[model samples]
Target: MPITLHDAFVPTAQQILRAVRGLVDKAERHCAENGVADSELIEARLADDMWPLPWHVRSCWVHSGYAINRFKTGVFTPDFTDIPDDWDAMRDQIDDALTQLDAITPDTLEELAPQTVGFELGGQRLMEMTGQNFLLSFTQPNLFFSCLHIL
Candidate 1:
């Protein structure tokens, strides 16, 4: 069977988003088990100059949410500011991304798959791609990269 755009994009994004959510779970459990504060995990980075953990989490949220909205609306608006500082905020961001994915129907994805659109960030045109190519090449890689960083 041929893969639809929805199949190519939605379920993969959803799975990665769930894995990101699980990272939050593991962090909370680790903090509780070791009597460490969440800040210890939230602020830690592999290097001093690297983004802190919250930035990774925020990037995951932003990438997932941005990919969904951009594919659906053909507008590439992405923001990673206002990083979630605590568990509730992090979970909320994950839930919000999941909700956005859930709102897209298979028909919508089919309608989008053949359309060529601008991929931009901050008013800069990154490139142009058909929706199917956008999903397969652009959004999926960004989502996975952010998810790996979050994990």
Candidate 2:
């Protein structure tokens, strides 16, 4: 009875990402059922200083995607230049993230576990840690934060 690295990372992240997709579906349904434009929700924020709803959804995908990408490559770049601005595009973003995460098999997670991983921001090295810590501490928390905001 032990929790392997694959159990700790892939399935946990996949479950949260799947929930992110569900949030997208719910948003679409809510808008249609109420005859309210998706923008009405997507563009709204809990406060003026906060990022809008779409940003939250995008971050959920981006954070998880970055973990996968960075674990494989040791580098991450901010490239939301083609941001998803509509409901369909948002759902596609989540789907694309799910696809990327799905590619990380149990074997892959095992390979990554003892390796060093670095987090980069703005073309500068941010921090480096073991892959396990990076996935469990930084990546999972940020991804969950994004998901929580959707509710």
Candidate 3:
């Protein structure tokens, strides 16, 4: 049988999920190497416009984490956005994210919701669940690279 668009789309989408995980891992390491143990750095403030780039980058990581839980039928909702307030557990969370995304299949993607508050994307009101989910997956890389550091 010929492949449907989804057959191609899911793997490509998985690569983005994987890349996001990679960058987040890189960022976490960068943070650790430069950090002063269990302390926080002032957030970056380079952007001069609304929806700053760091927000975009961090949201991709956060949303990717959210996507994983929603993707699995028999999994717990991980506290993706929870600041560990500690170092080791934080690194463990990053590792856990990579493991989760590596496990996704089309059957898994079909289980996720976009976690959106708005009614549309690009001014086109979405009518189906799968459409928006895949759309989010498509744009995830856009969000990730817009602020990710070289790593």
Candidate 4:
């Protein structure tokens, strides 16, 4: 089935969430590596700080679900914290968000406004939303790491 804006949003949200998961996983491994390497851990912290810093835990995906809804009411706000000290807590939420994303398809997406509508900040309205840009903002990582570290 052809993907729609809705489909794009959910998966893109999931993708962002997955990035968090990956970062958390990397952090965990780095911590477990017994100081053999600190670069990845340092990079993880830097990558995380790339987004608006969360004073507490709101900025993290564990609560923000990719920070798609900043106010938790679909509004843009300063949210998402850092990764949890115990990464295990993140599994279920990430899985659930991914599942929610899977439900998105062209059919549901068609109901959404065009790319120019702009993502909602709080009113659940698409006043200036544009699907294309929204999708990119959700999926694109401003602080992406290179393959060299993963290898």
Top lDDT model: 1
TM-score for each predicted model, relative to the true structure: 0.89, 0.90, 0.43, 0.47
By TM-score, is 3 or 4 better? 4
Model 3 lowest lDDT segment of ten: 71-80
lDDT of 3 by residue, 3-97 (tens): 54335444554555456446546656767787743233223334545343234444444445444454333222323255433334444544554
C-alpha RMSD values across all candidates: 1.7, 1.6, 7.0, 6.5
Model 1 agreement with the true structure over 47-80: per-residue lDDT tens digits: 7888887787777776665676776777666677
Q: Model 2, range 97-130, lDDT digits (tens) per residue?
A: 8888777777777787778887777778888888
Q: What C-alpha lDDT does candidate 3 achieve relative to the native structure?
A: 0.44
lDDT winner, 3 or 4: 3
Candidate closer to the true structure by TM-score (higher is better), 2 or 4: 2
Candidate 2 Cα RMSD after full superposition onto the native fold (Å)? 1.6
Which ranges in model 1 have alpha carbons more than 4 Å from their true place? none
Model 4, span 1-151: residue lDDT tens: 6655555455555565576667657666867877645343443433444522211222333323343333223334332334433446555445654665565555544543342433444546544434445444532332122111222
Model 3 stretches with alpha carbons more than 4 Å out? 1-42, 48-58, 71-81, 84-90, 110-128, 131-151
Q: What is the lDDT, from 0 to 100, of the residue 40 in candidate 4?
A: 39
Candidate 4: stretches off by over 4 Å: 1-3, 6-16, 35-44, 47-85, 115-127, 137-151
TM-score of 4: 0.47
Whose lDDT is higher: candidate 2's or candidate 4's? 2
